[model samples]
Target chain A: MVKKILSVAICAIVLLFVYAPILLLVVYSFDSSKIINIHEFSFSFELYKQLFRDQKIMQILFNTVWLAFAAAGLSTILGTAGAIGIFYSRKRVAKPLNAVSQIPVINAEIVTAISLALLFSMVALYRTYFSLIVGHMVLCTPFVVLSVLPKLKQMDSNTYEAALDLGASPAQALFKVVIPQIFSGILAGFMLSVTLSLDDYIITAFTKPKTFDTISTYVYNAVKNGTNSSTPALRALSALIFVVMIVILLVINLRARKPANKGA
Target chain B: MQRFHFSRKQLCIPYGLFLALFVVIPMLLILFYAFTKETDGNLSFSFSNFIGFFTSRAKLSTLLMSITIAIISTALCLLIAYPIAYILARSSFRKKNVLLMIFILPMWINFVLRITALRELLDLIGLLESQNYLNTLIGMVYDFLPFMILPLYTTLEKIDKSYLEAAADLGGNKFTVFTKVTFPLSMPGVISGITMVFMPSMTNYVVSDTLSNFNITILGKLIDEYFTTYDNWHMGSMISIILLLIIFLTMLATGGFKDNEKEARGTNLW
Candidate 1:
């Protein structure tokens, strides 16, 4: 009983450590004061209203979301196809290809960002949205390959062969038989790519044009400039993100529980 | 079946071309820019950029400071995460996945936002922009602790219970069983955890930037300044190459490359 209590206590403390800053962000979102003062506790929704009213913040939000979507979508398709190709190719060809794919995953983000920045400048494509998209795609695609490859390995190769033997065309066999088996991996990869792209700052900061600012670069600039850095609207944005995260967790939990309930 | 018009080899072309264009070529570009100097509209091979980096006391100190802070933060993360991971792995908790989700949910939020919020809280506690190493370490561990815990949890969870039982059956106590049977098996996770935490912590400037309010200069920040503020691409590329070398050495020291062959599916973040 004591051991169980100890374990629970440790878990509680760790979780508290993880959530404290988020909780603080949520709490401060409602503070009416311009600056964060622990002593001042004025409750208001004006910050959230202001967040919605701010055009620049809205633009940043749109850029971040659309960029994430584009990067994730493109990387998923490319990475999933790459994984399949690696799996089917001969060992000699596949080994080096697989190793090359992992370069982005293992390399430091700063290194990748700088290298891409250098490449863009050398090719005279610097500070373009195309550069930004390609940079993010480079950052995200490897993980997609990594995620999908495992699923491909676990899948039975004969399923596709059987589909071909049963009068299905090769393209049809690939689309219908092979893809469905690896769909979960693809979905996971897409989600991971979206999350990584959404969270990315180093690469985005390097490759984005001067006028283009994602939420990350925007927040970074706000903090760096120290002018209106502590705007309640920013806090509101944090609170909004925290709430969205909570909603995502709850939805994931509900979805996870449903299958178990059906099983039971 | 044998003579289908489409070949699997053809599928490799797009990604292979992408790898060459983006991955292979960019790295070559960094190397090219790092070693070549532009003089009178002509480029010549030179080591002046690299030599300048080593000769500058301030830059060398920044590099050392970054390494020091990374080491400290990685150590702190390990210390805090190991026990929690052990508890989670060994516990009979039915909702472990849910608990894991709770831990990882914060990571889903934008990292900069998390750091911003953390800076605010630290400001409240009189720690923000104090130029305190402890403050920076706290921010680093907070940002990175999940990376440490996830690997440790995965590895610890995979240990066979029968080994513990057998150790106990041989009169080994809890500590002995853990030391003899559990710790050695979890080394891979520890190594990966170190890699995950150390590499990012060393390379990450945002955590220190936010927490220190741009007062602290690490190697990453130096590289950023050289690239963005100073327009010294040659120096920036040289520092990046050095950083890459450090990463390569760290991976080698940790046997990360060797383990890749055995666990080719890749590192698990989920």
Candidate 2:
């Protein structure tokens, strides 16, 4: 009983540590005061209203979401195709290709960001939307390949052979037989890519066009101006994100539980 | 067979080209920039950039500080994560996956926003104004604890129960079984966890920039400032190369390269 209590206590404490900052941000979002203070808690949605009204903030948010979507979509297609290609190829060709794909994953983000920035400048494509998209794609695509390759390996290769033997063209066998089997991996890869692109800041900061501002770079600039200069709309943004997170968690849990219930 | 080989080669061409242009060429560009100097409308091979990095006390100290902070944060993350992972692995918790998901959910949220939230909380507690290493360490561990726990949980969960049972049958106590059997078995996870946390921590400046209010300088922040604020691409590239070398050495030391290649498909991020 004591051991159980100890374990529960530890878990609770860790969870508290994880959630406290976010909770604090949420609480501060409703404060009417311009300055964030834990004690000065008068309930209001003024900050959130301001967030909606601010054109610059809205533009930055739009840029961030659009960039994430475009990058994730492109990378998912390229990475899935690459994974399939690598999977089908002989070991001699695949080995080096696989190794090269992982370089971005293992390399430091700063190095990757600056290296790409330098490359863009050298090619005279610096500070363009194309550069930004490519930058984000480079950051995200490897994980997609990594996620999809495992599913491909676990898939029964003979199914493709069976389809081919049944007189389906190679393309038909690939799309009809092989792709469906690894769809979950492809979906997961897309989600991972989206998440990675959304969270990225360093690469975005270095490679984005001069006028383009993601939420990350915006927040960074705000904070850099001064701690006190951090906008209350940022607090509102955090609160909004916190709510969205809870909704996602609930949806995921519900979906997870439904399948388990069916199995039972 | 020959026809199949041709198609496979054709399918791989796009990705192979993408890797060559982006991955291979960018890396080469860094090397090229690091070793060459522009002088009198001509480029010549030079080590002046590297020499400048080593000769500068401020830059060298920043590098040292960055490594020191990474080591400290990595150690702290391990100490906190190991026990939690152990309990999570050994216990017959029905909702373990759910719990793990809850831990990882924060990672899905924009990391900068999360750190911004942390900065606010730290301010509320009056720690934000204190430009100290402890503040940065706290921020680092908070951001990276999940990375450490995930790998440890993965490996720890896979350790067979019979090994523990055998140890107990031989009269080994809990501590002995853990130290002798469980610890050794979990080394790979521990190493990977260390690598995951340490490598990013070394290059991450946002944590320090937020928590310390831009008061503290680390290698990553230095590199960023050099490239963007200072307009010193050559120096930045040199430092970047050095940082890459450090990462390569760390991966070698921890056997990360070998583990990654063998299980190249697994999403170690999870």
Lowest lDDT sum, 10 consecutive residues, model 2 chain B, at B261-270
| iRMS values for every prediction | 4.2, 4.0
Give the TM-score of chain A in candidate 2. Answer: 0.93
Give lDDT tens digits, candidate 2, residues B1-270: 554433544667788888999889999999999998888868889999999999999989999999999999999999988888888887887877567666656767888888988887787788878756888998899988888887788889899999999999999998999999999999988998888889888888989998887888888888899898998788899999999899989988888774342122224322
- For candidate 2 chain A, the 10 contiguous residues with the lowest summed lDDT are A255-264
Model 1 per-residue lDDT tens digits across residues B134-251: 7788889999888888778778989999989999999999999989899999998889889888888887888888888788887888889989999888889999999999989998
Q: Model 2: which residue pairs collide?
A: none
lDDT tens per residue, model 1, A152-212: 8888989998998999987899999999998877877888788889999999999999899
lDDT for A42 in candidate 2 is 88
Q: Estimate the TM-score of every prediction.
A: 0.94, 0.94
Per-prediction DockQ:
0.54, 0.51
